[model samples]
Target: MHEVKKDGILFHRFDHLGHCDRLCHGVFTRQGGVSAPPFDSLNVADGLGDAPAHVRENRQRILRATGGTDLMWMRQVHGTRVHIAEKGAATGTPVADALITAIPGLLLVVQVADCQPVLLYDPRRHIAAGVHSGWKGSVANILGRTVAGMISEFGCRPADILAGIGPSLGPCCAEFRHYQTELPEAFRSYKGPRSHFDFWAISVDQLCRAGLQKDNIEVQKVCTRCHDDRYFSYRAEKITGRFAAVIGLSPPQPT
Candidate 1:
């Protein structure tokens, strides 16, 4: 991942996606905004008890940094539902965990604190998706499901898709005390000392199982809980704001 500071706002761009001239994407950190502590600076989510005006301003800052004309965010219920982003879509948030779009200029976004924000792009088809996968969503195989959606809806081949797993809860801090009951047996192999699950590995495995080439996936591996200073961590702080992982197909450049 490459760190970029634009207009004083700091964010990250995956190397695989960064080289694509037709794409505009970012993994924004909680560094530049106007909100107070706990939700301090760059909190993009509107709910979660933050001031509405502050969230709006913060979102505007993000737009400026990403150069997106419009942003499409989901209600994010942690389910496998994937919404297709298109021009002139409805204003209300859709109740889904993933968003896919081929339309240029409509930025697809997923907000997260400790959950993994998986970004996928099919450079061949010029389509992109943003997925928000938490423990529940991971167990549900949201990453695989989103890839299937792209294949079905956009005729995108799995091998043509490039994926990036953004910073989230790493194994060092993802201790699941009641994994025997809370987590399924299939995830037992990922359990580490003291019951910490390596969700980053799990996401990569899910992507591969969905037919994506293993070499095409990039994992940021930057644990949010460990680096709470740069990102908001729900586990580390309990009360914190959400950062955004966004992707969009850029309009063609003038000749």
Candidate 2:
């Protein structure tokens, strides 16, 4: 991933996705916005106890940075439900954990503090997806389900898709004390010392299993808990804000 600064706001872009002229993608950091400490600067999640006005301002800043006309956000229930975004269509926050779109100018956003935001782009079909995958979502195979949704709804071929796993809790800080009951047996292989699980690897493996090429996947590997100063981590700071990972197809350039 590459760091990009637009109008003083810092975000990261996946190199492969960045090269696609039709796509506008970014993983925003918790900086360059109007909000006090704790939720200070760029708190995009409205349900997190942050002031509505501050959250609105922070979202506008992101719109300025990404050039997205509309942002379709999910309620993120840590489930496998995927919402499809339409151009110029407005809707309330749906009770889902993932969003997919083929409409240009409509950004699919997934808010996260520590949960992984998996961005998927099908350059061939000009479709994109934003998935919010926490431990429950991961175990539920939300990543794979989103890919399948793309294939079914947008006629996308999984092999032609590129995935970017945004910053989240890393294995070093992901300790699952009651893993034997909480985590599935298949995830046992990723268990490390102190019962920490490598969710990054789990996401990669899940994406691959969904038919995405291994080389087409990009993992940020930046743990939100480890870099709490740069990001908002629920584990690091319980009463904190949420950052955003957004992806959308750009309108075709005028002739």
Candidate 3:
């Protein structure tokens, strides 16, 4: 991910998906906004009890910077339920962890502080999905279900899908005790005694097992907890803000 600065707004872009002119997606950092400390700048999530007005303004700033409207955000219960984006459907703040869509211009977003924001896109079917996969969500295999949902609903071939795993708490910073054991036993083969678990690798493995071509997957190696200066990290700061990973089909060209 390369940091981009224009018009006093700071954000980053995925190099692997750079070829997709039909898509406009970015994983934003915690910079270029009007919020105060803790929330800092560009905190997209209203989850931290920030003023609603401030959140709205920050959201507007992002939409303006990205040329997107009406961000299709979810309540994000960290479950595997996936929803198809609808333009006119009554969105009752669905409890799904993932949102899939072939519908253009309906930007799908997932908020995260230390959790992974996974974006899935099937260029062949013009389908896109945004998933919020934290430790619980990962153990529940939300990543696999998201890919499966995109295939089942939009007829997206796993081979044709491109997935990106955005910044989050890396294994270096994601520590858990053996007794409580938040991660499942399947991760034991990939674990170490004192070594923290790597959710990024777990997500990639899940995508691969779901039939997505390994070459089509891109993982941003940046660790949110390690780079607290650039991103917001819940692990780094007990009460912090969240950055957003957003994706949607490009709008039609004007005649």
Candidate 4:
């Protein structure tokens, strides 16, 4: 991931996605904005107890940095439901966990504290998707559903899609408690006795199982919980801020 700073906002780009040309996407850090305390700097989740005005100002900073003001943000219920965001259909709706669209310039954002924010793009179909994959969403296979939705609704082939798994809680910090049967037996294949989970690996498996080529997937090595100086982790800090994984179609170049 390449970090680009513009107007105090930090935007991290996946090397696999190339430059800020046709496809634009960024994993925002907690470096720049005005929220103060726990939500200090660049918190985008408005309903998460952050003041509405502060959240609004923070969102404006992101919009200014990425040139996407009319960004579509999900309500993030941590479900497998994948909602398609058309040009105007996303303006005001019930919060959803994941969003998919072929609409150009309409940035699709997913807010995450400890959950993995997965970004998918089908260059062949000119479609993109943003998914919030927590343990629940992973158990429900939301990542796979995002790909399937793209294929079903937009004729997007999984092979041509490039995916980026943004920073989240890694196995090092994802410890589950006893008496917790929230995870199904299938998760046993990915977890060990240590009780920690490798969410990134799970996401990779889901993407591959959905038919995306292994080489096309880019996973950011950063762990939010471990790198608290650069990101916010819910597990690390009970009261933490939220970061955004924003993706949108780039404007056409001048002919």
Give the distance in Å from residue 233's predicted Cα in candidate 4 to where it truly belongs: 1.2
lDDT of 1 by residue, 61-169 (tens): 8877887778888999978798987667735689999999988877888899999999999999999999999999998999999999999999999999999999899
Model 1 residue 75 lDDT score: 96
Give the Cα-based TM-score of candidate 4 against the true structure. 0.94
Ranking by lDDT, best first? 1, 2, 4, 3
lDDT of each: 0.92, 0.92, 0.82, 0.83
- Residue 75 lDDT in model 4? 78
lDDT of 4 by residue, 95-178 (tens): 677898877778888888889989998887789888999988888999999999999999999999999999899888878774
Q: Report the lDDT tens digits of candidate 3 across residue range 220-239.
A: 98899899999999888878
Clashes of 4: 2
Candidate 2 Cα outliers beyond 4 Å, as residue runs: 87-90, 252-255
Residue ranges of candidate 3 with Cα displaced over 4 Å: 90-92, 193-195
What is candidate 4's local distance difference test score? 0.83
Q: In model 3, which residue pairs have backbone atoms overlapping below 3 Å? A: none
Q: What is the lDDT of residue 103 in candidate 2?
A: 82
